[model samples]
Target: MSRVVWGACLLVASTAFVACADSGQTAAVARLASGEVAVSGTPEGIPAHAPARFEFGTEASATRVAMWDIDVRPDGEGLPPGSGSVAQGREVYNVYCVACHGPTGMEGPNDRLVDSEQWDDVPSTRTVGNYWPHATTLYDYIRKAMPQLTPGILSDDQVYAVIAYILWMNEIVPEDTVLDAETLPAVVMPARDKFVVDDRVGGTGPVR
Candidate 1:
């Protein structure tokens, strides 16, 4: 072949190789003019404008995805789109909580403490209905932490339903009412008025 033709052939091969290089380095979150992002683990000849997608190194990173599995306080900010009935709460309890808090909300040997007749006298010192001052506090605590291994797995409604179920078990409220921010804080507990604040120096503590 002629020298000129040979040179042209070599140039074409080089260009083809560059175009077919590994495609592993680009973030796949932002939208470029193309409307879609390309990601790769290796970038042998990828353009600089492209996003990165490497595994161990920052050469390529992924777009952040929101995590919604955290427990939320009863304030309503983190509440999921759900509402649970006392019956529904019972279901949740049976599946996730009853094992720990006992079958009938009583203080079983290793189960969670509750307001059953067995612990009526002992529970007034710490049970949900006998000790907790605000029903919202129960919701908040349970919403953020409960069911042992899987915390914050239940939706807001489920949390409320569970709270209501537990409360009903303690004879604090009916088993049909819904639990929410508005209704939660006001559902007075037997120990509601007995709670005193850290008022050793600051007058009589936070105003009611």
Candidate 2:
């Protein structure tokens, strides 16, 4: 049985190698736009290369590195210190967001940030309130890539405020709610229980 499995593995490996080589080869009748015959496959054998151990680029400063390391996790980890209220968010929305996202977050030329009362409407939209599992995701995404044209310009307070407004519009949070790193993660989204973690490895085994 072991020998059988080993033979099968070798056969599979050889077949895969052949497939890769075949894929690299161009069709026999293929021609370039300039009316020249195209090279079929890459030249055989690996070419001379640079030293693998050679290092490039200066060591980056911690402060400069921190700017790019702004991804907030699902658990609200990496949230910067800041707070914003629903009222403040509404004002921010009107000023900076209304152009692309429309009056409310729902009337959008872009993706709607507000939740729909009914999901069965003729023009259905997937919103952050009803679809997103984590509130931190909102804070993270908005802070990283909002305002459309000029991304990463909003302060932490503004990001929090806009998140608050969107959450309020969805009815996920009360209009008077204040959002910060501490409270943002605590506001469990409606779809939180719907998502399941997939840990599968091999098809016939238990979740890894």
Candidate 3:
């Protein structure tokens, strides 16, 4: 008696089983011995038992892709069109940010956003103002993830406003300054010079 074994094969679009008969019972014996059996009805290289096409999900729409494509770079490349003042930022911060960051941004239940000491002072607590290397990153971070409870809930205007308020509290910007794509990136951070470039290439040792 000849034994028949069904071997599983995976096509680019579908999965199917290839029939293999041992004991020289059929033409598939030679191909099956080489682990490459040809199915009767399938196309040249495809298995006959496989479906013509199979896909897991629908294609993503342009609008859906755009929604997740929001990312701001250090040079302010991707900043959206919006403007926000310190006063407006204060309002937005009080409503949405004060609970986690506290009224002045110093007394925070979360990470502190303001620090009175200069970067050279080597402050024990690493606040945003004393440790952050770029001002543009503040806008990126707040816009993408903020408010503790709900992330990405703030509009562009609101995000700019909140950043302005935080910058003012840190003494990095004037209390009356308004933040926008044009002005926000140009605001130099206090700790900008503190960070060193990582020029080291691949190695097994420490980064230094």
TM-score, cand. 1: 0.53
The lDDT values for all models are 0.61, 0.75, 0.76
lDDT of candidate 1 over 115-172, digit per residue (tens)? 5333433443466756766566666577667766898787778887888888888887
Residues 86-154, candidate 3: write the lDDT tens digits: 999999999999999899998878888899578465767778778888888988889888876999889
Best by TM-score: 3
Ten-residue region with minimum lDDT total, candidate 1: 24-33
Model 3 has an lDDT value of 0.76
Error of 2 at 105 (Å): 1.4
CA error at residue 20 for candidate 2, angstroms: 36
**Candidate 2 wrongly placed segments (more than 4 Å):** 1-55, 116-124, 197-208
The regions of model 1 sitting more than 4 angstroms off are 1-81, 110-112, 116-124, 199-208
Candidate with the larger lDDT of 1 and 2 = 2
Candidate 2, residue 179: the lDDT equals 94
TM-score of 3: 0.66
Instruction: Provide the lDDT at 100 for model 1.
Output: 68
